[model samples]
Target: MAEMKSGYIDYKGFKTYYEIYGERKDNGKKPLLILHGGPGDTHLYLLNYRDMADLYDRQIIFYDQIGCGKSNIPHQEDDFYDYDLWINEFFTVRDALGLDDFHLFGNSWGGMLATMCMLRDDTGVASMVVNGSPYNCQTWLSEANRLILYLPEEMQKAIAEAEAAGGDYSTPEREAAYMEYYRRHVVGCDPWPDFVQEAFKPENVGECFNVMQGASEFVMTGKMKDFNVLDQVKNLKVPTMLLSGTNDEATPFLIKEAYDAMPAGTEWVLVQGAAHIGNATHAKEYFEAVENFIERHE
Candidate 1:
């Protein structure tokens, strides 16, 4: 088993926490850098990749983006939640760790961030895997609305009411209704996993989530509400693999838009019976596909 080492990096005076699983071996492959979802999500849920590092003798990296998880939180102001700030942090962490070669894996918002990073600089990226990410906020909301209609009529009503109240998902009925949508499109597992639950704890929830992703998944009243990269995805020159679940909020249609926009030869995969976080609900298939993709590129 590879030993896990954890540490913090100082970036622009802010502290970002990171954990590395498995020491670099002479396997001739670069480390796999993981980017967690949420404009504020922690890297806790991504711990599933630790197994891949240990078993495959591959190095895996996980980091809590600034203002999330174990990282230091900046002042709670909307101005602090800039997309370029996080993108710069990604490069800072990569260079700080001396990762000249790496396979980038970004989930959800992370996937969106990864795309932005690759577009900004693709020099060091050997390959990329985008999981359950949205290329356009409008498309995401449209698909989410479509999915919401599939919920029970009462639940749909509750959700609509909650959204109308400015995303006030405080009532038990409203919360339950939101969870119904989450279970169907977010985790796709019953008895929500501990790591998934941990991500929403008070300390784990960062200002970026509210400032960039809005108050809730269904709402888009944030700075990133208009974020769209479909027009520029074609600029990605790296070998990329796009992954999404059959029931993901990043619906197949949206994923297809990204896939079709990417340069030829990019891969697209849909994990059946899984939702947004396929690495958690469908670990076997998810890791197998990831490992095979990385190996093929290597």
Candidate 2:
């Protein structure tokens, strides 16, 4: 394993922590800039993706978005956590690192952010890979409701009762029901991995998740409830690929909808038996698909 280089960059009066794995050699292929999910998820779970640096000789960069992970948290004002702030933060990090060419990879909410970045400007982005991203909130919620029906009857009842009571699904029973749904649709791994566990820690559960994503996956009581970029994706001219798991909350059906809205020639891949975080649960397959797409465009 290559030595990891970690540091922080000042972006608009906030500090953003980032780590770099593998050196950027004159390998022709550009470095990969990875955007993690959650408006609040740390780059910890995405550490698995650093394998791309080792296997494919690509420099892989992972960063904690402002107000999450090791980065400095700003005041949670009404105007603080919007799409433009994150998009600017991304370009700030890119410019600070002096990356002239790079491939963008974003998971879940991060995927939406990456798409917005491309839609804003593709001047430096060489290609993109969006994993389990939701382009339309209504489609996402509708699919989630469909999947919820497959849960055990008792679990379904518990979830319904909890959501009906103003999203207070924090009881032990409710937690158990949520986990049952998670094990099936969020992560297919039997025993959840440590990195995944770390993201959900009390201190690690940054305000962004609650403020941007709400209490649970199925519930949407946050500012991001109306976030939909389907109309803008058609203008994205960069070479892009979409990925989703067969059992993902961002189902293949939803991913296909986003793919259909993208400019023609965008690629799509669906991993079997994997859930939301396929890059973690199905690293080999995920990396192969990602590497192939990047190489084709390179």
Scored by lDDT, the top model is: 1
**Candidate 2: tens digits of C-alpha lDDT, residues 150-181:** 98898889899888887777898787888888
Instruction: Provide the clashing-pair count of each candidate structure.
Output: 0, 0
List, residue by residue over 1-298, the lDDT tens digit for candidate 1: 5789999999878788999998887878778999998888899877787898876789999999998899857576678779988999999999889988889999999999999999999877899999989888889988899999999999999999999998998999999999988888888877778877877678887878888878788888888889999899998998999998998889999899888888989999888888988876898889988888988877
Model 2 residue 182 CA deviation (Å) reads 0.9
Clashing pairs in 1: none
The candidate 2 region of ten consecutive residues with least summed lDDT is 71-80
- Where model 2 places Cα greater than 4 Å from the true spot, the runs are 72-75
TM-score of 2: 0.97
Candidate closest to the true structure, highest TM-score:
1
